[model samples]
Target: MSRRSLLSRAIRSNGEPIKITIDKSGANTSAINDYNDDAGADIEIRQNKYLNNIIGQDHRPIKQLCKATLGFGRFRTARITIGDFESMRIIRKR
Candidate 1:
């Protein structure tokens, strides 16, 4: 009998691009405070406890771990978190 592995992965996301800045002597401290409040390091740690899981040290598309067969209807997927993918900014790709 063949065996399959079921791996579980967890991801935490806050939708936004991270901005970096230098703390040089600025002319405006208020602006700096605002920017700092709105920005910081965007770090994500996916924990996978199963083999072939997306969160393992070596990973694949987390979305692939999820299986869904869409048929006879339009499929709308949101915030696909299983992969190391870019943001869906909803801008024109063409």
Candidate 2:
């Protein structure tokens, strides 16, 4: 689960992003810089905590629920479970 591998996997799955907003983590900044240099992609990185708050807030419930379960056995299972949880949350909101 190195940062580069994670970033590459995300890009591979979701396609390249035009910009990315992240916290002020040097490792993440370095990884993005390296990725841009190696791949010749210009993906802007913004390190503002305020911009990331919405994402953090939205995941709080999922994190709480998963924390109780001690995590899923596989990535697919986690993805599916979280997807279901998010769907239900959205439905409840409407």
User: What residue pairs clash in candidate 1, if any at all?
Assistant: 62-82
Candidate 1 regions exceeding 4 Å error are 1-27, 41-94
lDDT of 1 by residue, 1-94 (tens): 1111110011124343233222332422344344345555343222223432423433233334444322223223433332213333223232
lDDT of each: 0.31, 0.93
Best by lDDT: 2
Error of 2 at 42 (Å): 0.9
TM-score of 1: 0.15
Model 2 clashing residue pairs (backbone): none
The stretch of ten residues in a row with the least summed lDDT in candidate 1 is: 2-11
Give the top-scoring candidate (TM-score): 2
Candidate 2, 55-74: lDDT as tens digits? 78977997898898888999
